[model samples]
Target: DRLKEFPCRIEYLSRLKSASQQREICEALKAGKIDIVIGTHALLRDSVRFKDLGLLIVDEEQKFGVSAKEKLKALSRQVDTLTLTATPIPRTLQFSLMGARDMSIIRTPPPNRYPISTMVSVFDEQLVAHAIREELARGGQVFFVHNEVNKLPQLHAMLLRNLPTVRCAVAHGQMRPSEIEEVMLDFMAGDYDVLLCTSIVESGLDIPNANTIIINNGHRFGLSDLHQLRGRVGRTNRKAYCYIFTPPLDVLTPEARRRVAAIEEFSDLGSGIQISMQDLDIRGAGNLLGAEQSGFIVDLGMETYQKILDDAIRELKYGEFSELYGDELSNEGEWVRAQDCQVETDLDVALPESFVRSATDRIAIYREIDLLQDESALNQFEKSLEDRFGHLPERVKSLLTIPPMRWKAASVGVEKLQLKGGRLSLHFMSPGDSPYYGSQTFAKVQGQLSRYAHACRVRQMEDHLRVDVDGVQTVGEAMTFLDYLSNG
Candidate 1:
């Protein structure tokens, strides 16, 4: 029997046929004939039951409705349920963040990931032709993104006029479902050089040869939507390119500018993912803890909110550890708002809301953050924060580590070192030095040693390049640091 293929001796139940067939399948499952089965919601009718059911797997958890989720959860009492999802929604992320569920983040991007090259510019017919020619030279495909469905035909005609030799197709949601599917298949089969579509191309479409995307009028889409649409390309090892075309400058809204800027800044791999992750984190915080908690994050600021979350998690689960000193637990730092939180201060500085509201500004902000590594820029930054927040948060202080006389004896890969009164601490990220792993590399015995020195600091010294931080401080002054950091 096919049931044997499941490595079991149970009957098979399927509801792909008529209502009567579904009823029979449910009856079979209820009668203890089927041990492992797969079917749609039709099999979830109340009349169905299970005898000695031990495991259940719900594929594509996001596809299920709330009522269906409740019914599925009820099954959890008798069966260990495994809910699977590639891209989970806000509610699911919230459940994972809270203690309601356990999760494992698959942060390892696909193995063949080559950084996506992104460019933002006004619509240039020549650039369009060049981008298409480049992809064609590499024997690759292209995704010409003209998001407005009503103008899709006109856009398709324009593409045909410019890249006349390259076969092209159009796909949009307004078309018949079957037609959309056929066009997508045709694109995949290499029958078309470009697939001009809306955001409908945003998910679950993998075309390895397609490495170039030109999103026309990209200013209209949100940062997350733009990120997802760009993700449709760059599925191969080749360097993918994304051109986000925006409307003219004078006509552009501040919000539109921000969107385009974000697209430009997030043209790289890890960068775009980080933007998406931060968005998810903010949404998750809001959904699980209530909108009031979300507002609190705005009041406290992003880094402060993260500190609070880390503290809350530690207090509830691990309690205050003996190794962590009381004075070391204090918060001392200045706060600059991250993308997740927004605050208004009595200064000319643009608040974090500016970043959250517009993609163009977000990208510009990121680029600016990247430039904060220079010593002169860092000095200028201290002044800027002081000017913006009125006063730097006393709780926030930077950890300045000077290498010992003997660099070799200083231990390998020592990223940070700090001294508080007579106590000294080293901050490094090595599996061999991990306290959690019980592989403490340094054998130094002192009165009070701590590794929390890396809690929040602005910059890290490097041989060739510097790692910049917008704002950071020692954990000891964390709270006071937050008060100043946030208000500043």
Candidate 2:
């Protein structure tokens, strides 16, 4: 009915339809007579072609097979594409996190929506009966998900025997498409009080009246699957309930226990992102770039991979060197060692327990500090810490000086800077081997070092130059001396 009011023609194509119907739809699409077409993977077939497709929208994108997505990608290159998903697969989420793709998140739930009350417990038939009775008394419906199709009949019979007065129906993927559609429509029209179904209800189904869900063998499903199943309920102002039934905690696998616990903990509205991050932690993020890159990422570790990825993106976007590598160095088109600086100091540079309580949070802060690329980032981090955790302690302030020291070290071509045993050592790569070594800046630095001969000693090793400065006992003194060397 809505299609009649639209300015453009619309067509629907599906594998379930007759061959003549599909052919007519294909012809209409190819002739540009149809401005909009909705269908399944049949649309990706070579026989089906679009004349002037402008936008392609994929819903439940995570449910599509790899080949279908690949085919969609081929089509997407020529048109704008938008993907919608409640729970994104880890690969898609990783791409968005790494800035390879753009993503917009809708955190706001509809008005009058309340957080679903979730509970994980050992399966009890009486408890299930009680929940169903409560929802039924309130004029609502229920979804009882039992994944195994072979056992669904047994479960359905049990439900009927337990609560004979309540109307019940079964729906699963193994059922005929027409049968499934009929059962779903019947449920939608309030013909059934409860629908016994499989994970097929995990996507593209919404029933505002179905405010109670009971999943059998919930521990057998993945975290995202559990989340999606739970999402089927709680669509209206009425309060909803989700019961995740599993075996005893002691009997369940460790992974299953964790999944159940996580689902229970994150029951608030708009917690999908948090749940997805937990999914990534449990399941490793596969290769985002390609298959070959997966091996590199595993070998480099996620932290190092993130640093390299950030560097590559920055270099491509702004033609700048990596944060760790000060600048690119090449000799006659031959790659040389990356011009970088390292700081190795034995100072007690760590967050105090009195300052930040959580060990996990401290480690997170350390990673953030390790990735600081510029003075502005460092300053901002310090300010944030002070704002969140109160005044910066003396040691914390000293720790903030490390990044600038590293930046100063790179400026003077010092590849390695070490402070230990009341002495500071600056290691420089060989002049002949380094592109930055023979520059006028290097000469000026050398001249400046010669002036401080009394306090600093310079030695020419077989492959590099080493400068040692005595009496740098504290981190502050080390910072002061490095500042002098970099500025001089």
Candidate 3:
């Protein structure tokens, strides 16, 4: 019978020790005994074959050997293959760019994923002990990351000396497969309070209970690596802390500063999207495509690079891309407005965040929009702006700076539109029949034009100020009561 949790029937392919089960499963897959299976490299073998395989999903594709990965690809030929890896390779980025692969980002670290508060300081035993105690007090586990596996014993001894009562263990790749699994299982089961280990803990393990991490010699790691490592903890709602300790003797590298700084910057939810995470996305894109595309990204920048990819995707999807490379596009304003005619005027307009993300993005977006010869496209793009951001929020409204030209007009005694008392009111006109004139006041004539008193005075005011009322008609004057005024 199919298991309730799984869509397909589940069966045990072999009965063997955990160490040897991977190879056994690979042989089983080769013989077509399992519909879908999960195992490590031990499951990778020449004999492995699938009988009408529908999908092959491999988690952590980076761990696979190049030849093995290539062979695996062939196995899923003409079938959908979903390879997952936390550290995305350049090839994956290319595939996403070229539309060869579908990518989904779990960028929002799970809900209540407390951003790990990281601190960079010289190694200190007291600080380490205090952090460990604090986390354990909150019923959380700790990961003491020390990359050097050879110094595992010495490190463990130091950790013991600092916190002798705390249960702890060490793990590395050199350990036997069973031993590594046992330690991981014990740690997962909450058998250990702390795990002093290598970078193997970077991905594929979710331990919400682990809320604190201490990375020894963290400056040695790259930004991406450090991000991945930091991601290991703070899976729960409780605030997590990651302390990166580096010796003062070591000259702090720029990359190290960037890594630590990113960890600090992203402590708030949804805040790190623009920085470290984007770099990961870019790196992933580069990995999937190839190193050759890296230069294109560096030259054009990430936003521009993404725009090019988006354009290519649209062209491939719709079969009609208006702007071809090397096409001479005119920037005449009249032509732009003409193109916009295809779009209904009533359609709501929206200003793209690309226009608002930063000054650079805004300038580039403006330039790109200007180059568009298609009127409907521009209108559609504008409509997108209105729909996405809605009526401008107060925060955005605050950024509005009245043009200097208008400021000059106000200074020269010219009345202009302004927001006064939350309503637009004339600078010189008022409800009460009072002369509300500025410093260089000339004339303030108010009364119905139909009234003889108003008619004679209006003429006098217009003549004195040299104001032209020529060929101008006021409908309200002869019907409903209206007021007139002239001032300097």
Q: Candidate 1: where is the Cα deviation over 4 Å? A: 1-101, 110-112, 248-263, 267-273, 280-284, 289-300, 305-488
Higher-ranked by lDDT: 1 or 3: 1
Q: Per-residue lDDT of 1-488 in model 2, one digit per residue for the tens?
A: 45779888777777567899999898888898888898877899999998988999998776775668889999999899999887777777788887678999999999999999999999999999999999999999999999999999898888888999989999998888889999999999999999999998997788899999999999999888999999999999999999999999999877678788999999999998888766655564676656421122334556665657665663453234433444433221212222457788888877999999999989989889877888888888999999999999988988887877777777677778898889999888544445556566667777778888899989888888899999998767877876676565
Count of clashing residue pairs in every prediction = 33, 0, 20
TM-score of each: 0.52, 0.74, 0.56
RMSD over all Cα atoms, model 2: 5.9
Cα displacement (Å) at residue 46, model 3: 2.2
- What does candidate 3's lDDT look like per residue over 326-438, in tens digits? 13222221111111111111112334463366677566544555344444665565566457545644433322212222232233223323332222222322212211232
Best by lDDT: 2
- lDDT tens digits, residue span 401-447, model 1: 11111122122223333334323233333233223212222222110
Instruction: Provide the overall lDDT of each model, using Cα atoms, as 2-decimal numbers.
Output: 0.58, 0.82, 0.56
Candidate 1, residue 408: CA error in Å? 26
